[model samples]
Target: MQTIWLTEAEWFAILRIGLGLWWLESWRHKDKKDWFAGGGIRWASGIADKHRWPFVRRGFDLVVKPRPRLMAYIVAYAELALGLGLVVGFLTPIALTASLVLSLIYLVLMIHDWAEQGQNLMMALISAVGLFGASWRSWALDDTFGLFLQ
Candidate 1:
């Protein structure tokens, strides 16, 4: 009997596509009024309140609270762009890096919430693996187009 195991590249490709679809779906479900208007501020404030780290709380209050609309737009568009990049395996490393950064931010802000923290931690791990394994070069536009080759 022969057992076949998927290669790391294959696993990473699956992960990339899955994560991309998750982000895309999340974006698709968002309501503009809730994401871009006062709702964003309220959500940020709730997260800041939940954060035990004073630095993170202060950062959210000082930075995020001041420009809720801008932050909302940045987050919404970034998710869409990252989703597209990851789904098409284009610039995978860059998309993964961005995912990692966003995951870390969420982890910090939601540390007090075990469920959210765990989810963000998992995302960060996935991003790290994809970035370090050079999965972008496998089954990706970067490979076909000869872009970002190390």
Candidate 2:
């Protein structure tokens, strides 16, 4: 069999696109009514209620409960923006960092669910890899446009 090797840039591109699509698909499937004002809040509250971390529980109570609609909109739009940024290879470092943060938050909030929490952890790790690789400029719009340099 022939050996197949991928360059660091190619690997980063794949990770970026994959993670972007994951977020994009998640946002696409959400219904505004349910997510912003109805079932989604209830589901999230249930999970928050079960969260073992007192800080996370308090955060949920202080922020999510007080302004769930605003939070929902923020989450949805952030997901969309991050997904688009990754897919288009724009502001890649920022997108990756945001992905990592969001993933960690999910992992912490959903600590009771091993499967979901594991996925969140994996996503966080992937984001870390993408960030540390610093290959965002290799095939990205940011490189083309000379934006978000670091």
Instruction: Give the candidate number with the greatest lDDT.
Output: 2
Task: For residue 92, give model 2's deviation from the true position in Å.
Answer: 1.1
Could you tell me the TM-score of candidate 1? 0.89
TM of each candidate vs. truth: 0.89, 0.90
lDDT of 2 by residue, 15-132 (tens): 8888889889878999877887756767888989888888988999998888877888888888899889888888899899999999998888888888797678888988898888
Instruction: Score each candidate by Cα lDDT.
Output: 0.82, 0.83
Number of backbone clashes in candidate 2: 0
